[model samples]
Target: MGGNATVAVEATTNRPSSASIVQTLGGGSGIDTSALVQSLVDAQFESRNAALAKREETLTAQISAAATHKSNITGFSTALSTLSRSGNLATQPTSSNSGIVNVTRLSGAVLTDVNARVEVRQLAAAQTASTAPVTDKAAPVGQGTLTLTFGTASVADGAMSAFMPGAGASVDIIIDASNSSLQGIAAAINARNAGVTASILTDSAGSRLVIKGGSGEARAFTLEATETPGEEGLSALNIGIGASGTTIGSAAADAIVAIDGVAIKRDSNTIADLVPGVKLDLVSAQIGVPVNIGKTLPTNALLQAVSDFVDTYNEVFAALNKDLDPVTGSLKQDIAAKALKRQLQQLTLAPLASGAGGAPTTLSQIGVRTNRDGSITLDSTALSRALVNSPDAVEKMFAAPSGAATTGNGLAAALGAIAAEAANTTRGLGASEISYTKAKSDIATDKTDALAKADALRTRMTRQFASMDAKVAAYKSTQTFIENQVKAWNSQD
Candidate 1:
């Protein structure tokens, strides 16, 4: 053996060189293969994932902004409708003496300023009759068929003088064993509804069978009783042309009222058709005295509505500006949101109605003025002056929502129409929100796909690096054995 011996292994047949293994494996150099594979996969899709995440954030913000814009306009329209239905825009009526007559304006009725002098001379009277008092109220009166006939009657000195039968079948009142008593007969007449009523009047003495007909001359009725063979008590209630004992009652007359010294006659005291929109609810007779019914203005309600309009209009205007901002807004690119600004301006500017030559015809004329910031301000003094000068014109300028559906007339109608259009799902604010939501969903799908690709890349790299790791361990073992053998050879030498 030689004095010093050394052996080196250069087994590079079908593999990488030793230098390449050291650089690739980093076995004793604290290099991790799993971490390296993950870094590679991240690098592959980092830029794409970042872009998708930013798009998702933007779409979510846009959806929120569109919803907010729709909510603001919808709230404004709802408030306007509420103000209209509160009757703040109508003219209230006032009665001088409510005890004599009470006056009220009907809903949706156009009422003029009427200070009419109304007088109720005499209330309408109905023809009434009463039978003689009897000893017992529940005792059987008779069993007969009492016939009633309607007619036009003539009165001479508060008594029936002549009668002409009207064209109709006579109404029959059946008096049988089932309804033979006074109380039973009254109930039978009520059930018939034959333009007359029957009742039993009982007092300290006895009970009397009283019958009354409706008011007016044409409502006067005649009774004809045909008694059975044994029941003759039914004949006591008979009153007509051929009555043996019963006498006819006084004539029924219509009510009499005077307006402008012109007497008016009607069947009822509650006169409505005489005046176009005025209803005179007569309570008592005032032969010559007249009560005045005048038109009154609701100043407080008008002022409150004006104040509320200003507040709500300002809120909607502010929301429009922010949502339609060209730069920082989330819904800046939405066409429906952008159109609201101009629509709001036009609605506030348009005239609700045409007034008198010198009267206010528009909201601005009554002092709902716009500011530089696209909001509105209320000038109460101008409105007060307009109301004082021409109350009718002021009322015509702001028409409220009316009818069963509460649809607006002028400004309310206009605002509601535009709000409804903007909120339409097919091509408006609703559509914008839908589009944004769909885009966000698409972004989620893209992010998932990108992550999947990255994971697959990581899996491929992990397998490839595992093979290299195993080879590095084998090469290190071979290198260690060669080195140990060389040292033993030197010792042997």
Candidate 2:
């Protein structure tokens, strides 16, 4: 190992090997290279942020569209409800073919002491001379008289009474018990009240009396015999009349009420339809009908529509917020996502300021409110009240007015203008129109554009890595060449 004999010790340079160069440069082992890698990481985050921003924008547009659709449904529903409330909807008119007549007693009290008598007579002759005559002609001259006897005290004691055989309870006095017949009974009952319906029922048995009580309670019947002694004909007819002394009250019918100069006929007999959007229930029908008008909306349909609108709006907003919120850490990183979220919040809250002077400046006016975390809450009760109080105001706030320049910042109009250059369709855009076609076409086009941008950003990041890898390889090659030169120099020595 002496140095005199030309020791063959190989000299090697301290230059790094290829593997070391790659580890130091490509693997980001050094501070400078680590910083560059961090830059690429930051770029990746930016790409993600850009994607989320685009999604947020699209979702914002979608929420606007959904709000517009909801507004349209609400508008149509409100219009129909107005018609119903105003009683403008079709109804069957009152029938006029029949006549109604009221019947009331002139005496106002039941005739308890009246006498009723009926006689049966056959139109043909008797079968035999000895046999009793069933017909009036069979009875010999003046032998056809049939009479009912009422005692002398019958009328005074209120014991004598009479009634039409089939009549409900109406009866007339048979003044002459010896002479009054069934025909006289029928005539008296028929002439009592116009409300009663009277007719005769003639059959094989004989002619009988049939009477119907008028609209009022049944009339009382009593009979009193005329004291004519030795009247065999009156004694022969043993028709006994009794007293009926019961009374009942009659029910009064309903009357019609006119609404807004139009006869909106209802059996309830109420004046509720005079005021629009109110419902009244009939309370009683005595002298006149009384009613209680209900202030609440009759149906939950309108409230349900508002609820649906809120649900749909919240769904789209939630999706947007998930992508844009910084704390959630979605596919989109922070910068662009945060910007977009801030922009959306600003846009939504701008009109809510008191100075905005629009139809619905506050979220509560249109059924929305802010939660503790800046999220939105649906105020259904407030919304319902607002709609019930001023439905047209809400409708005009969301939709274009018929005759005037659109003063309100409606959802459809706002979204249409904002998404004009983007590939989203706004609500109320017709299918045949060029703007609408373009808007529809843009949905796919916008998505594609977003994807393309994301891909381009990814490609740029990869190219940058590739360039960094090439630089590391070149640095390793240089180190290898220098080491070889040092080896050659040492070998020559």
**Predicted structure with the largest TM-score when compared to the true one:** 1
Please give the CA lDDT of all the candidate structures: 0.75, 0.37
Model 2 is weakest, by summed lDDT over 10 consecutive residues, at 120-129
Decoy 2 TM-score against native: 0.25
lDDT, candidate 2, 157-241, per-residue tens: 3222323333333333342443245455345435554333334455665444343332211222222233344533422222233
Per-candidate clash tally: 0, 11
Alpha-carbon deviation at 491 in model 2, angstroms: 33
Candidate 1 to native Cα RMSD, angstroms: 8.0
How many residue pairs of model 1 clash at the backbone? 0
Q: What's the true lDDT of residue 69 in model 2?
A: 35
Cα shift from native, residue 369, model 1 (Å): 2.1
lDDT of 1 by residue, 1-493 (tens): 2222222223422345444432455453346876787788888888898899889889988888888878888888877766665667777777788888777676555566576777888777788766777889789989999899888776554345577888967999889998899899889888999998988888987888788889886788778788988887888777555554444455677888787667888887677865556777778779888877788776677777778888988877787787677888777788888777777876656766556577766778888898888888989999888788877766754456454331224567677777787789987788888888998989988988888888888777766775677566656756776687789879999
